[model samples]
Structure formats: structure tokens, C-alpha cells
Target: MTTERAYHHGDLRRAILAAALDVIAAEGPTALSLRDLARRAGVSHAAPAHHFKDRAGLLTAIAVEGYGLLAATLQKAESLRDLGLQYVRFAAAHPAHFQVMFRPELLRPDDPELLAARERTRNQLHTAVEGYSDDPAIGVMAAWSMAHGFATLLLSHNLDGLLDGRDPEEAFLSLTNEMFQSAKNPATG
Candidate 1:
């Protein structure tokens, strides 16, 4: 139950979203619950429902926001390699959003906001590799896969031992540089 003061607060929605992100960061997306978020936010159990409708709705909102953020980050990149590095950095900086954004089953993929946000991200990637490949779509796919795979590996702690005491960002940049070099010169690869 929410205290009267909490119910009257103007930022309940933001509070709920922040709580949800914290929960997802600590326990993964599967553990997220509106009721728990409400408790964490000091709001009524029904408050989250009022804002998001349901679990899928909440996840959809997260996915939409995540895509928008990723698009904005990618837009700042001056090169294709920088774009890939930004992708990995975004995942590391916002693990909860990254997790929810990639799991389509957990979200309402057909939602208008989600679709628009996703297209923005796709466009950013396509523009980044526009001149690098004759088939830009394939280039976008390869770049997305490489960054997504590396981010997933980092998030899952699969690269802890493999990093050899280097910072994850440095290691990721090194790996991307090597990949870009190999793509440029297949004989050297």
C-alpha cells in the first residue's frame, strides 16, 4: 500500500522505472515484477499497472527507451569501429536495458514506440557502414552481431579470465580493431 504522500508524488512513474532497472540489474529481467517495483518505489501495488498495464508493457517500455538510447549513442560515433565500440559500451553501462532490449519475447515487439525506436537504431548502424560494404544490410548485421556477442560475453562474465587483467573497454576496442583489420585484409587474417 502506498502512503498518501507517495501516491501524490509527481514522479511515481520515474521511480517505478528506476526501481525496475535496479531489480533487473540485481536479479536479471526474469525477476522483475510490478508489485516489487511498487514496493521499492514506495507506491501502491497497483501504481505500476496504472503506468505500464502489465509485465510485457513494462518490458516494452524499457526496450523502447533502450533502443532510443542506443540510437543516440551510435549517432555520436565518427566511424564504423567507433559505432561498434559504442554498442558494447552502451550494453555495459546499461545492462538492464540491454538485457530487456534484446529479448523480443519479453516485450510487445509490435508496439509503435518500440518499432520506431528499433528503426532509429537500425538506421544509425546502416549509416555507420554505408560506404564500407556494397550490401549495407549485411554489414549492419555483422557489426550488430559482433558487438552484441561481445557485450553478452562480458555481461555473462564469460570473458573474465580471457581479458587478461585488461579493462573490458580496452580489450573490446582491441578485439574490434583486430576484427576490422582482418576484414580489410583477409590474407593477413
Candidate 2:
């Protein structure tokens, strides 16, 4: 067997979760199970329980990791608009996590790690609008709406089918920019 299949110790949890993501990405959430993940990870069927109490625990872990990854992606962008594009890209790239990340009810908000990751993403998004206008609260809410709407539309294929000739990201950026700019114009107020 390969060294990767050895599974000596120290990171079995991560390895199992990675294997789980691979399965979920390939098949779907319906096909995912701790025993199946443990098999893919080259560990014993009982091994996963040491990390995840059950299937729900595994799903929670996936959601937690997804939130952290989303936060990191948002933080990497130079601006809120760029972050919105990146958010769509990230969702397309990590469909496994993207599938679970948003259903907040699926995760225990009381779980410290999940909450921290969620808050980190929220704060990062809030920071992205720090220079938008004098009212940080309004600016943040507007940016949030744009990003969330764009990401949701992209994921749901709402824009994917409608944006056949144009780049969806560019279209989203252009449309939101114009609308927000128009809204900000005092002449229109």
C-alpha cells in the first residue's frame, strides 16, 4: 500500500474528513457515511467514531470546515465585489462544502468552532465594505445582499442559464455596481 494508505496516526480525523469530502463531491451527501469514509481513508470502520460521534457529527464537521474555508476565500479578495465573484468561484470549486455550509440549522451554532468560523466570515464581509460609505452598517448590509444574492443565484443556476453569452461574475458585478451607485446618487433620492 502507499504511504498515504498507511494512516499511522496524528491526523486520522483530517484524513477521514478529506476522504469524506472526496466521496461527497463524487456522489453526494446521501451517499456519505462514517464507515464509508473510514474505508476510503484506509482506516478501520470503528476509527471514525474517535473523531465523529456519528453521521451527524461528520456532517457538522464538514459544515464547520466549509465555513472556515469560505471565510478564508472572502478574506483573500481585495474588495467586496471581488469577494462576491470569489464566493461564486469557491462554491463551484467546493460544491461538497458549499452544499452544507449555508444550512445553519444543520450545524450547532453552540459549537464554538462553527460559530467562530461563521463570525469570521461575517466580520470579513463587514470589513470589505469599510470604505463604501460613511454609514458602515448600511454599506455592510448592501454588500452582504449583493454577495449573498449573487452567490445564491449562481449556485441555483438562476444566472447560469440566463448568462449564456456573458460572464456571470462580470454581469453580477456590473449590475450591482450600477444599482448601488444609482441608489447612492443624491439626485435620485
Candidate 3:
């Protein structure tokens, strides 16, 4: 029953986004609603509409922010393996954002901000794979697919008992090394 007046003093856009992330983490993205976000932010339902037009807009904003955060994290990584590790860590740290960032059907994929942010993230990935293999594009794709698949598995708890009691990071590093080693020695079938 709070009013828009409650949001008069601060950045309502960021507040609404934080509420959306909380809701997404607790109930999944399908449960997100501007009205629910407004309730969590202690504002009128229409307040979120002013900031995010609708649910797709809100999810688009989240995707943009997620990509920017991912780009920053990847930029700080020192190597391809470190970049992969950072990708997994980012997913673990921001599951809500990670969930929405890759689901294009749930976001406004044509949004300029979202597109730019995605490109920045892709550039970071490409940079990580540059000079690591004969075909940089394929190398980038392979590294991205492996990191994304691993992060998704971890997020879904599929790696719980499969890790055999080893720490997740240690297990991930082992898997990453195994992948690279196998790439260096293709098997004949």
C-alpha cells in the first residue's frame, strides 16, 4: 500500500532493478512482475512502469547490466582459463542476472544498450582466446561454450555429487585443463 511518494528521495530505477533481481532469484524469471517489484520497492505499481515500461524492458535492463559486469570481470582475468573461471564465478555470484542475460526470448534483444553490452562481453571472450589457437573464432566459441555449459551445470546443482568432494573451483580447473589437453591431441576414431 505504499505510494510513489516513498521513492521521492533516491534512485528508483536501481531500487526497482534490485527488487527484480531478488524476485528472479527466489521465484525464477517467469514470476517477475513490475507490480511485484513495486511492492518490494515500497512504491506504487506505476512507479516501476515509469522506469521500465514493462517486464521485458526490466529484463532487458538486467541483461545489459549483467553483460557489463561480465565484461568487466573477463577484462580483469589474466588468461583463457582464468576467464573461464571468472565466468563461472560471475554466474554463481549473480545467478539472477546470469539467468536472464542469456535468455534472449525473455528480453528485448534489439535494445541498443543490451546489444552494446553483449558485444562488449563477446569482445572480452574473443580477446581471451586470441592467439590461443589456429582459429581464434572457433577457439572463442569453444571456450565460451565450455564455460557457459559448466556454469549452467553448477547453477542447476548438477555438479554436486559429481565433483567427488573436490572443491568446485578445483574440479572446474581440472576439467578445463583436460579439455585443453584433449584439444591438443585429437583422437582418431
TM-score of each: 0.92, 0.80, 0.93
Query: What digit string (tens of lDDT, one per residue) describes model 1 on residues 39-146?
Result: 777777898899899999998988888998898888888888888889988999999999999899999978999999998888888888899889998988898898
lDDT of 2 by residue, 155-180 (tens): 66788667887877788778778886
lDDT of each: 0.87, 0.77, 0.88
**Candidate 3 displacement at residue 57 in angstroms:** 0.5
Best of the two (2, 3) by lDDT: 3
The TM-score of candidate 3 is 0.93
Worst 10-residue stretch by lDDT in candidate 1? 1-10
Better of 1 and 3 by lDDT: 3
Q: TM-score of predicted model 1?
A: 0.92
Q: What lDDT, from 0 to 1, does candidate 3 have?
A: 0.88
- Give candidate 2's error at residue 125 in angstroms: 1.4
Can you rank all candidates by TM-score, best first?
3, 1, 2
